[model samples]
Structures are given as C-alpha cells and as structure tokens.
Target: MKCIIVNDDSEMRKTIGKLIGHSRGMKLLSVFNSTSEAALFLRDNCVDLVFFDIQMYDVKNLEFIQNISERTFVIYIPEFSPFVNTTKKPQLEQLSESTIAKRFKKGVDEARIFLKLIKKEKPDILDDYFVI
Candidate 1:
C-alpha cells in the first residue's frame, strides 16, 4: 500500500518510516514534517495509507486527516510513545501461542469494526495496524 509519514519530529518520522519500510505489505511514498505539506500532496495524489502523528504543530492532525479524502487510511501514532526496552524482549518472546492468538484476535476485531464503518461509506480503504 502507498503510505506517507507525517510527524513534526524528524527522528520520530525516521523511526516510523523505517518500520513502514520493513513491513512486507506497505510502500512508503514520502515523509512530511508538517500537516500543510502533507495536505497539499494529498490534494492530487491517491495514497492508500498515512502513518500520521497524533500530535503535530499548529495544525491539528486529526482535523487535517478529516480534510483529506475519507478513502485514505490513517494509523495514528500518539505522542505518548510506548517505551519498549530490550528487557521486554525476552518476556515478549516467552508469550504462549494462545496469548499471541488472543492479541491478534483483539486487533482483528477492532479492525473489522473500523473497516465496517469505511465499507459503509468509502468502501475502498482497508488498512490495518497495531497501535502501541
């Protein structure tokens, strides 16, 4: 899917962009430091997804998202970033299959509900992501 990263913080933008690049199902189109730049780009482009920062300068990210075509899917990364340290890796790795399955199911259920709303309206944008 074609995607863009919009974040005021350059480092945050890079981090999210790298994650998107590593994802097997996404295509990173471009990265923007401000909402206006991204808004202008979207005026004439058909982007499938946008990795948007929940907190952006001056312009409200949510409002900016609303102005765009509803056909676009946005995965909002809140400013309160989750600090996942190396210490958590071992514990996470020890998760049982059922535990993993439960988490996956919860994510899928939320996505299904969101998609249902979109399908009733745009019916075109179907993207999913885990909000940490």
Candidate 2:
C-alpha cells in the first residue's frame, strides 16, 4: 500500500518512515513535517494510507482527517489523551504511542480489512464518504 507520514517531529517521522519501509506490501511515498504539507500533497496524489500525528501546529487534526478522501486510510499517532476522541470516526484508526513498531502492522492490516468490508457493503460508495 502507498503511504505517507505527517508529523512535526523529525525523529518521529524517521521512525515511522523506517517502519513503513520495512513492512511487507507497504510503500513509503513521502513524509511531511506538518498537516498542511500533507494536505497539499493529497490534493495531487492518491495514496492508500496516511500515518498522521493527531496534534500539529499548522492544522486542526480533526478537520484535516475529515476532509481527506475516504479511500485513503488514516492511522493517527495521537500526542494527547483528549485527541483520542477523534477515533470515534469509524474509518479512523489510532496507533498506541507506547508501541508504534508493534502496532503499525496491526493498524495496516485493520485498514485493509476495513476497506474490504466497506467495498463489500457499498460497492458504489464515493471516495468522499469520509466526513465529520
């Protein structure tokens, strides 16, 4: 699956990018230091997944995720407990900050399952089905 990482911390970005590089069937398309940069990329590219930080300085996490294409899955890396509420959205998944390497593969597997289920249930669903 094609993917991107969005995080303000350079170290976190490197960590996640490396994890993606090592994962089977996963491709690291790009890494951005902020949500706005990722958003701009999304406008022209069609990636299958995004690893996004839930708290960023440039954009509101909820709004950014809500606006992205539904076909593009999001795995959130939340920085605070309060931001965990964003996972209430059915299509959104959260990766535990404590065990990123352990959880990354699980999150990707879950996303694949979710896309299959959604396609089975509504074959004609638009890519914009993801909304707040």
TM-scores for all candidates: the values are 0.62, 0.72
Clashes of each: 0, 0
Cα lDDT of all candidates, in order? 0.63, 0.73
lDDT of 1 by residue, 12-86 (tens): 676666656655566788899889889889988888677677767644666687786655556675554333434
Give model 2's TM-score versus the native structure: 0.72
Candidate 1 off by > 4 Å: 60-62, 82-132
Whole-structure CA lDDT of model 2? 0.73
Best by lDDT: 2
The local lDDT score (0 to 100) that residue 33 gets in candidate 1 is 84
